[model samples]
Target chain A: MRHTISVLVENKFGVLSRISGLFSGRGYNIESLSVGETIDPAVSIMTIVTTGEDLVIEQITKQLNKLIDVIKVVDFLEIDHVEREMILVKVAPRKEDKPEVLQLAEIFRGRIVDSGQTTYTIEITGEEKKISAFIDLIKPFGIKEFVRTGKVALAREGTRKGK
Target chain B: MKISGAEILVECLKKEGVKHIFGYPGGVVLNIFDVLYDEKDLQLILTRHEQGAIHAADGYARASGKVGVAIVTSGPGATNTVTGIATASMDSIPLVVFSGQVPTLLIGNDAFQEADIVGITRPCTKHNYLVKDIKDLAQTVREAFYIASTGRPGPVLIDLPKDVTAGMSDFVWPQEVKIRSYNPTYHGNKYMINQAAQMIAHSKKPVIMAGGGVILSGASKELRELAEFAKIPVTMTLMGLGGFPGTHKLSMGMLGMHGTYYANTAVQNSDLLMGIGVRFDDRVTGKTEAFASHAKIMQIDIDPTSIKKNVRVDLPVVGDVKNVLRDLLKTLKEIKEQQWGAVRSAWLKQVERWKEERPLTYRFDKNIIKPEFVVEKIYEVTKGEAIICTEVGQNQMWSAQFFKYDHPRRFLSSGGLGTMGYGFPAAIGAQLACPDKIVIDIAGDGSIQMNIQELATAVINKLPVKVAILNNGYLGMVRQWQELFFKERYSHTHLESGNPDFVKVAEAYGAVGLRATKPEEVEPVLKEALKVKNRPVFMDFVVDWKEKVFPMVPAGAAIDQMIFDEEKEEKKLKAVK
Candidate 1:
C-alpha cells in the first residue's frame, strides 16, 4: 500500500541523509519524496510517499521519530486529511480543436497558462484523482509535456495532531 | 571556519576519526591531495593502482567496522575503482570512495580525464553525490560518511568536480542531516521478540544459519548465546565463516555449494532454520524451490528486503542482528546444559562419521605439488589463528573447505562479488588493522595477476603479509569444468607459457619470493614465509593442474544431487583400486 507520511523535522544539515540512509539501508521503496521548510523557519516538513506493509510503515515511523531532529511523523492515510495535487500540462492542440479544448478546460476549472500556434499550456489543481481524471480526459488531445507534484497533504480541520 | 572544499574534505575525515586514507594523485584530485599533504593528523598510503587503493579501503572497512575511505582521479582513475566499489557494495562493506571530476564548465564537453562518475557509480553505491558547489562539500562529505556507515553499510561515492574542489567556501560540517526518505530501524519490537522466543522454544530440531551480518553487527557472542540457549546447531555461509567457532560441536562448518556434507544434511533435515544475518544466497541454497522445504524458517536480517529475497520465512524479524539477538536472549529460557550436551554430542558424532567417510584429503606425490596439501599445511601451521583472505577460483574453494576459521571477521574474502584480485589487498588491509596477528592471502596464479601490483604496497609498508599462491599453470577452475563437461577442449584456460616469473617479480617489489615445485616443499616454504617479520613474502607453489574441488553440485542442481570425488571418471579407477 502507498502511504504519505508528513514528518516535521528540525532544519539541520545531514538530517536529509540520515532519513534517506535509513530507507536505502533497509531497502525500502520511496516512490516520491519532497522536503522544504514550512512557515516556521526552524522546522522543515517532508512529505514522503512509500509502499510497504503495516509493520514496515509502523517501523519506519518509529525509527523516524527516534531521529534527534525529527519532531513528528504523521501517516496521512490513518488521519482525516485534505490532499491536493497540482499539474502543469502542455498539449499540442489543432487550431480547430482549441475551442473544444478550452471548453473542456473550463468545465474542469483549469486555467490556460500559455498558448502557441499549435500548443496550449494548461494548469490544474485538485485532489489526486481529479487531476488524474483531467489528464486522462485531455490525453486524446496529445500531451506535449506534463509535470505533477505528487500529492501534498495536510490534516483536516479540528484534528491538530502533534508528535 | 573559512575553508576550501579540499580542507572541508579533510575536516570531515577528522570528524569521522579517520587516521589513514589510501589514494593516488591525478590532475583533478591534486588540490585534495595537496590539502591532505599539509594535514599532519591524517596519514595517507599511496597505492600504484586506484583499484588497489579502493580494495585496501574495503579491507580496512571489513577489518575495523569503520567506513574505509579512498580517493582517486577522474575518468580512468574513477573507472578503476568501479570493481572495488562493486565488490564492496556486493559484500555490504562500509566505504566512502572519492573521485575527482572535470570542472563544472568542462563537464559536458568531455574534458581531459572526464567521466560521469556519479552516473557510473549510482548502481554500485548505496548513495552518491556530484558536488557542484563548494559550499555543499562539507555537508556532502558528512552525509557520505553518515550514509556509508549506517544500517546495512555499503560504499558511497562522492564525485567532486575540479572547480568544486578548488572553490573556497565557509565550511561548517553539519551535525545532523534531515533526509526523511532514509531511516533504518535498529531495534526490534517487543511483541516480535516474544514471538521469536516462542518459535525457538517450540522448535525441536532448530538450526541457526548465520551470515556476514553477525560480524557487521558485532553479534557473534549473542549468536553463540542464542544457539546454546536453544540447543540449535549452527551452519554459516562463506561470508559467515568464523562467525561461529568451527571447533564448537554445534558449529556445522560451512553450508551450501562446497559446504561440508554434515552441514548440508543438517540444514536439509532440520525442523526449523533460524537464519540470522544471512541473505540465503544461491551458493548456500542450491535449488531454491527445494531448499529447506520441510523446515520452518525464521529470518532475522538488518535489511528488510533480504527477508523474502530468497527462501520464504514464517517469522521475519527485521532489525540489527545484535539487537534482535540481545532481545531474544533476554526473553528466552536457557536450555538445560545436559540436554544441550546430548544433542551436540549426537550432531558431532554424525559430523565425525561423515568426516571419516569423506575426509578432505588429497594424495601428494614426490614429484608434483598439490594445492590441497598446501592449504592443509597452512591450516596446520597457523592452527586456524590467522585470517585467510582468498582470491577467486580453485584456491578460494580449497581454502574455504580446508581452513578452519573459528572466529568472525577472520575469513575475509570477496564472497558476493568473487573479485579475482581481492585477496592481496584485503590481506594488506586486514594486516594493517590487526598488525600483531597473522594475515595470509591464498591466491591462484590467474587471480594474483589481476592485482599483483599491490606487492609494492605490501613491501613498502612492510606489512608482513604471507601470500600463498597456488600455481596450477592454467585457469584451474574453468579448465576443471571444461575437462568434466566440455570434452577437455580447453579454449583460453592456459597460462603456462606467457607469465612473469612471480619469484623475480616479488623480489623486484622488495619482497621475499619462495617457489615450491615439489609437494614436500610446501610446508617449509609456508613456514619460511610466515617468519618474514617486516617484509612481505610470496610463496608460489606449482600444484597439479587436473585437480578439481569435489563434492560438486553443478549450477542449478539440487543439494542432494551432488557429484562426489569417487564419481569422477579419473577418480573412479582409484576408488576401485
Candidate 2:
C-alpha cells in the first residue's frame, strides 16, 4: 500500500538527509516525493509517497516525528487531501498544425510559455492523472521534451485539526 | 564575497573540512584545479589513472567514515572513474566524485572531451547533478557532500560544465536543501525496538550476524554490548569481519564461502538468527534455500530494499544499527551468563574440533612458496592488528580465510563489485585515514596490473602501504575454475606472456620492491617491508601454480558439498592405514 505523508520540517542543513536516511536506513521505499518551503520563512513542507505495510508506515511516522527539526507528520491517506503536480511539455509544432495545437492547449487550460519556429512549450498544472492524460493527448504531436514536478500535496480542511 | 563557481567549489569543500582530494587535471577541470592550487589548506594528490583516484577517494571514505572527494575531467576521465564509483555504490561507501563536462554551449555537439557523465553515472550513484547554472554551484557542492555522507552512505557525482565552473556568480551557500524524496529514517521505533527485544530475550540459541553497516554506523561498541548482554554469539560477513573482536570467546569467526565450519554449522542449527546491518549476500548464505532453515530470522538494516531482497524476516527493524541497538538494550533485561554457558561450551567444542581437524595450513618448502603459507606468515607478523585490503580473485579469498580479523573496519575489500584493482589505492586511502595503523594490500598478479599506475601516487605521497602480490603466473581464480569445471582449456587465463616484472615496476615508481621466490624469504621480507616508515614497498611472492583454495562448495552447490584438497583427501586415506 502507498501512503502519502506530509511533513513540516525545519529548513536547515542535513534535514533532507535526516528524512531520507530514515527511509534508506530502515529499507523503506519512497515511490514519489516533493518538498519545498511553504509561505513560512522557517518551515519546509515535504510530501512523501511511499509503499509499505501498516506497520512500516507506523514505524516511518514514528521515526520522522523524532527528528528535532521535524514539527509534524500526517499520513494524507487517512485524511482528506488535495494533490497537485505541474508539468512542462515542449512539442514540435509544424506550421500547418499550429492552429490545432493551440486549440488543444486552450481546451486543457494550458498556457504556451515559449514559442519557436518549430516548437512550443505548454505548461499545465493539475492532479497527476489529469496532467498525464493531457500529455498523452499531446503525444501524437511529437513531444520534444517533458518535465514533471513529482506530486506535492496538502490535507483538506478538518483533517489537520482532527489529527 | 562574489566568486566564480570553481572558487566557490573550493570554498564549500573547505567548509566541509576536506583536507585532501585525489584526481588528475585536464581541459575541463583545469579551472577548478587552478583555483584549488591557490587554496593553501587543501592538498590535491594527482593520480596517474582516474580509476585509481576514485578508488583512493573511496578508500578514504571507508576508513574515515567521511565523504571521500575526487575531481576529474569529462569524457574518458569521467568514464574511467565509473568502476570505482560503482564499487563504492555496491559497498555503500560515502564518496563525492566531481567531473568537469564540456561548456554549456558545446554540450551535445560532439565537442572535444565531451561525455554524458551524469547520464552514464546516474544508475550507479546514489544521486547525481549537472550544474547548468553557476549560481547553483555552491549549493550543489554542499548538497552533494550532505547526500554522500548521510544515511546508507554511497557515492554521489556532480558534473560541472566548464562554463558553469568559470562563470561568475555571487556565491550564496544555502542554509538548507529541500529534497523531499531523499528522506532517511534514523531513530528506532519504541514499539519495534520492544518487539525485537522480546524476540531476543526469549530465544534460546540466538546468534548475532553483524555486517559492514555496524562499521558504517559506528555501532561496534553497541553491538558488542548487545551481544554481551544477551549472551548471543556473533558471526560476521566478509564485509563485517573485524566488526567484532575475533578473539572474543563469543565470536564465531567469519561466516560464508570460506567461513569456518563451526560458524556455518551454528547458523544451520540455531533457533534464531539476529542479522544486524547485513545484506545476507549469497557468499554469506551458501545455498539460500537451505540457509538457516531451522532458524527464525530477525533482520535490522537501514536500507529497506535489502530486507526482503535475499532473506525473509520474521521481525524486521528498519533504523540505524546504533540507535536501534541502543533502544533494544534499554528495553531488554540482561541475560544471565549461566544461561549462555551450556550453549557456548557446545559451540566452542565444535569449533575447536573443526580447527584441530582442518587447521588452516599449507606445506611450503624452500623451492615453492605457497600463497596460503605467505598469507599465514603475514597474519602471524601483523597479529591481525594491521588493516588488510585485498584485490579480487584467489588472493582475496585466501586473505579472508587466513587472516583472523577481530575488530571492524580492519578488513577492507571490494566485496560487492569484487573489483580487481581496488586493493592498492584503497590501501593508500586507508593508510592516510588511519595513519597509526599498518595497512597492507594483498593482491594477485593479474589484479595488480589493473591499477598498478597507483605506485606513483603511493611513492609521491609517501604512503606506508606494503603491497604483497601472490604471483601465480595466471589469473589464479579463473584458472582454478577452468581447471576444475572447464576441463582446463586455459584459453586466456595465462599472464606469462606480457606480464611486467612487478618488482621492477615498483622500483621504477620509487618504491622498494622485494621478490620472494622461496617460503623462507616470505617472512623476513614481509617483516622488513612493514618496518618502512615513510616509503611504500611492494613484495612479489612467486607462489605455487597448482595450489587452490580448498573446502570449496561450488557455486549453487549445497553447503556440505565442499571439495577438500586432494592431498588432504589422500592424507585421510593414509590415516585409515
For B1-577, candidate 2 gives per-residue lDDT tens digits of: 6788888898889888999899999999889999987789898988889999999998888777888999999999999999999999999999999999999999999999999887677657887778888887888888888878777888999999999988888878788875554667788777788888877766776778999898999999999988887778888887887888877877877777766666776788778899999988998887888888888898898876667667778888888999999888878854333455554556556655765666555666668998999888998998878889999989988988788887677888999999999999999988888889999999999999999989889888888899999999999988999998999888799996788888899889899998999888999999999889887999999999888876676888655556778887798899989
Specify the CAPRI tier of model 2: incorrect
In candidate 2 chain B, where is summed lDDT lowest over 10 consecutive residues? Answer: B334-343
Candidate 1: regions farther than 4 A off: A1-163, B1-5, B38-40, B132-135, B163-182, B334-367, B567-577
* Local distance difference test values of all predictions, in order: 0.84, 0.85
Predicted structure with the largest TM-score when compared to the true one: 1
The per-prediction tally of clashing pairs is 21, 23
Q: What lDDT score is found at residue B169 in candidate 2?
A: 81
DockQ for all models, in order? 0.10, 0.06
lDDT for position B255 in model 2: 76
